[model samples]
Target: MTKILLHGCCGKMGRVISELSKKYDNLSIVAGIDKFGSDNMGYPVFKSLDECNVEYDVLLDFSRADALENLLTFSLKKQKPIVLCSTGYTEDQLQLIENKSKELPIFRSANMSVGINLISMLLRKVAPVLKDNFDIEIIEEHHNQKVDAPSGTALLLADSIKNSLDTETEYVYGRSGSSKRDKNEIGIHAIRGGSIVGNHDVIFAGDGEVIKFTHNALSREVFAVGALKACQYISKVSENKLYNMEDVIGLDF
Candidate 1:
């Protein structure tokens, strides 16, 4: 069985993950970590990862990046693997995660939905070919309470397109007076309004045609289930590795 330490197990997504865990015979959340005083489903909630006494093979972290450093430290000390589902990390923090991948298996992804990962791979392949003829734009909308703008999945999609092109491409968050998009720019837009779970649409516009690719997340449970799948996969992987949704779904990205 895949014993898991589920961080942020009191949150909405955490509850979804816990419920999904019950459906699988191979996966179980043996412990959880939450805020020091927060109650979390009767599981012993440790304020810090180092305080946890339970034995688990891997960690499924749905907490914020502020808690990442401590969690990663604990994982390294225990030589356990982790699947990071949180977003909004500064560039330096991201660099730290990449550096730490040299020692442990870390599966980090902004969006764990299988469809979104496939969209990323497809954009990478199509961007370079349509670089000159097509204008690319990404628009994402999430719940009003979402703290981050231009969600991590949006950045991932933009980065994939940028990397596929041979030359550098600028990202245009918004266009104001006297500013026109450059030929080599990718526009990313964010919308926050209601309780919409999640929505992403990428539009490729050319002179005569426009092609749109979209994914709608009807429930947060998709992410929860995806994270659990990653937890199971990470529990069996060797150290010194980096993985994403493509690895979990066995697709090329």
Candidate 2:
């Protein structure tokens, strides 16, 4: 079995991963790290990595962005590969991840759902073709309990679209003022209510033609499954590089 150290072990995603690990013969959670240090998983849960003494092969963090720096330090010091699925990182914190990846393998993605990653690839192909005439807008929805707005998947989708176009683009989040739409601006809107798992819709409008691409997540298992696949892939690879879902899926696991 590929032993795993699961961070954010007490949250919803953490619990999802814990339950899903039991179904995978090759993956297992050896220990956990959560702010509460709750030991509900039968494995020891440490409030801090400094107190961790268990053996594991990979670190799967589904925690918040503030927890990233410390997690990266511990993972790099211990020579452990980590799967980073957290979002809402500042520019400096993002740079920190890039810097640490030079030492150890880091599998990171804003969204771990395979479908969303595949959509990112498709956005690259279509955005350029539509950039000249079509105006692009992104709308994302999630559970009311989610703390971040526009969703990480929304920003990832935007980045993929932004990279394809030749012209520079500015992201306008939830526009409010009485202003006209600009050609170089991409509007991102967020909706939070009920228990929606996840929803993202990307629209390209020009003249009389419109193109819409959307993905709806009905269950949280898709992300958990993707994370496990990544963990399995990273456990076997010996490269000291920053990896993503593309790398994980490319391995054909």
Best-performing candidate as measured by lDDT:
2
lDDT of model 2, residue 139: 96
lDDT of 2 by residue, 1-253 (tens): 8999999999999999999999988888999999787857868899888889999999999999999889999998899999998889888988988888899999999899999998888899999989999999999999999998879899999999998888999999998889899999999999999999999999999999999999999999899999999999999989888999988767331
- At residue 91, what lDDT does model 1 achieve? 94
Question: What value of lDDT does candidate 2 attain over all alpha carbons?
Answer: 0.91
TM-score of each: 0.95, 0.95
Root-mean-square deviation per candidate: 1.5, 1.9
Which 10 consecutive residues of model 2 have the lowest summed lDDT? 244-253
Q: Rate the local accuracy (lDDT) of all candidates.
A: 0.86, 0.91
Instruction: Measure candidate 2: CA RMSD.
Output: 1.9
Candidate 1's C-alpha lDDT?
0.86
Question: Which sections of candidate 2 miss by over 4 Å?
Answer: 251-253
| Distance from true location, Cα of 206 in model 1, Å | 0.7
